[model samples]
Target: MIDSQSNNNHFISESGYLSSILRAPVYEVVQITPLQKMEKISLRFNNIILAKREDMQPVHSFKLRGAYSMISQLSIEEKKRGIVTASAGNHGQGVAFSAKKLGIKSLIVMPVVTTKIKIDAVHRMGGETYLFGSNFDESNKKAIEIAKKNNYIFIPPFDHPSIIAGQGTIAMELLQQDAHIDRIFVPVGGGGLVAGIIVFIKQLMPHIQVIGVEAEDSACLKAALLKGKPVSLSCVGLFAEGVAVKKIGLETFRLCKKYLDDIITVNNDSICSAIKDLFEDVRAISEPSGALALAGMKKYICKKKIKGEKLAHIVSGANVNFHSLRYISERCELGEKQEILLAVMIPEKKGSFLDFCKKIGKKIITELSYRYFHKENACILIGISLANRLNEKKKIIDNLIINKYKVIDLSKDEMAKLHIRYMIGGYPSKNILERLFSFEFPESPLALLKFLKNVSTYWNISLFHYRNYGTDYGRVLTAFHTTKNSPKFEECLNNLGYRFHEETNNPAFCFFLKK
Candidate 1:
């Protein structure tokens, strides 16, 4: 079995960082499985596409390989104390799995925002858990403090040497499995996986290109390169929460500077689109972070005209929440196709709708949200989808011109949507007033206060809309009286309060299904 001895004596000056990673238990090279059709369409580089299936590793992701190796390096004394970590997602599960096998006490601290699915997964693997913090950063901070106070061994997600060593073993597996590799695209978060893989490959193969794939919303590498130092991002997009890191780890970043070829950032829409493609082609439910490599590669191929190149994207994980499928479906179209948002003013007459439909024709309608303002003026917001690599959206715009139709494509103009869409809906009047609530809103009633804060200054509400299910929208519905003098809905409810009525035979409330 490989250990610290091989690492110590192998390469002190030139390869010490890489040597620590080479001795991981996952020594076998991940098989370089060639996808037949994909390789034939060669890019700017050489062909013979190789998919190094690190996803096939224990725990179903490459995390185990690193976590196991990192934990293994602990001294006998340290091992006796066991380990603690903070990960509501993959890292928590990985550490737990590793600790369980090693017969160590594993404690995982997760953020309260963590999904039930992940929490249950950690528990199933025999890891004790503590839920704390509102976000990952908060949870991580608490975990660090706990480790220091309790004297529990702190197993970091990607910053530790043992972890990096275990992760690097994937590179060993890749080289040993197939020596002929052109490029490897790995999903990146804190740079652990990419750093480990790159260090090993460059030390051994030196010729292979190791690219890092990161979410466009939180591109630590791109920001770091631009700034000439690591900087924390103000905010990051949440769709690919797994890899949405504000900053890269110190140790991983140091190695990445030397080994990684370059880092590519892809947006949530693109990552979601890649997830759909992977699901359809491989029947694999890849998480957003996991599918990032494929999305980046596709974007790169289109932009750089990169052909004749052997490409492999990491299908990193499958621990996807079932509820997120709707999000995946929504963004998939936007990712694959350049979106065109238009507000068309058509006559409210009978044949006007049909006339506009005729102008739209074959282009797919990705989104359709409508508003009826006046009897003569009804507006329909349309999101038209166009292929990024192939279709020209201007053709559709040109058709609208020839047919004497008004058009405003907001796809390329985000500022237009941010500042204009709300104003575009209707003239600010009593008719436009809405009592909006959403389940996604934080539990604090600040939005309600904001609404009340603005009241009596402008116009009074004539109609208020509220439903119990408005939790999805977050604007709770109180009883709204349409007549003037503006009755206070809340006061009446407070006075009379709630009424309890039971009707076993009530048709609306019946649970029985009719045949």
Candidate 2:
């Protein structure tokens, strides 16, 4: 058995900050999850790719380690008084599981929009649940209020010493499991997991590179590192809810700035692709935040043209809500570059469609939508599957353009992917006065009706698109018939107080929605 205290003394410096998190007392509740070699991925990348299976932990996440470590070390009096915490999902389960194991009362405050699977998991583990607010920041405040009111010890999700130490234990296991590790990729939220891993790796192996990964829409750590302090994001994307923290923890930022070799951000598509990759490799599905490290590693290796090096990515968690899979599965193909989006214009004549098909010779057509309005010309939105390199897409596009087909690449266009693709139909109508706007509102029943009630009833609703990703906010792509283009429209929108973007002249909107 490894002596936790001796390990602390052996590796820690005189600094209290580093010494306090040398080892977490999490062995009783946390397991040393397997460090599995990703054979197919290694072959493809021409590198030794390994995955630390933290998703296999009792709570199916690394969070339990930290939660247990923090709670287990509390004094008897503190334990009797109980504990309180707030989490988007995984951390609450961790705390609930830890509290149950330790015979301590626990209450978890979660955002109202948290997925049912996670909330149910916490309740099943014996934690009292409080659904409050719209996001983590709001829920965290409520948790603090309750803690103060009840005089319970408040355990922060990722900011405390013992919590960080517990997560760092994974690094100890990684070193013992594989000494040949050349680089380690870890996902970052408030930065607890990455900070913990870094404290150990930098002190012990110093030569190994530690890379932190974050969602492009929720990159608090990267933002903090660049700005030299934690700054709140104006808005955060909820696709990767687990790591949707708008700000980094104070202590976590300090450690990450000092030790992390590099920090990279990945888009939602890349995250979805990484989730698919993990599923392919181990038949294990990872949540968006969980697959973040793999996505970053892929981008890093490709950009640097690095090969044949041994790399490891932390599979942070696997507590994905099942319903979210529909969105992920739909997007993963595009993420992997297997699906390509193209806008093609053809002659609006008999057999012109056949000519277009001939030009796209032998390619698998995933989607093809064409509507002829003008007597002389027609436009079609097409999705094709590419069996060859992504460069092959460029060649295909060039070939179509050479044949007098106007081609626009919609593969990288966010608007096209999220809204336009599904709503591809109907040619431009004359004097209809189409105006496009994107609106954000709380995800709740009658939110759409409430929005419509606020807008002027004089305008006819022309185009509308809405999708719920099981998040706190709902986004809607809406078009209305209105000729009022002066300050009146702006004044009306300002009065409504809804966060909206005018897409009236947006390129994608013009291409697909407008005449």
Which candidate should be chosen as best, given TM-score against the real structure? Answer: 2
lDDT of each: 0.64, 0.84
lDDT of 2 by residue, 339-396 (tens): 8998888999999999999999999999998776679988789999988755888889
Q: Quote the positional error of residue 248 for candidate 2 in Å.
A: 0.7
Cα-based TM-score, every candidate: 0.77, 0.93
Predicted model with the maximum lDDT: 2
Residue pairs clashing, model 2: none
Which lDDT tens digits does candidate 1 get at residues 225-319? 67766778866555677786778877777777767787788877788788887766656677777788878877776777666666666677777
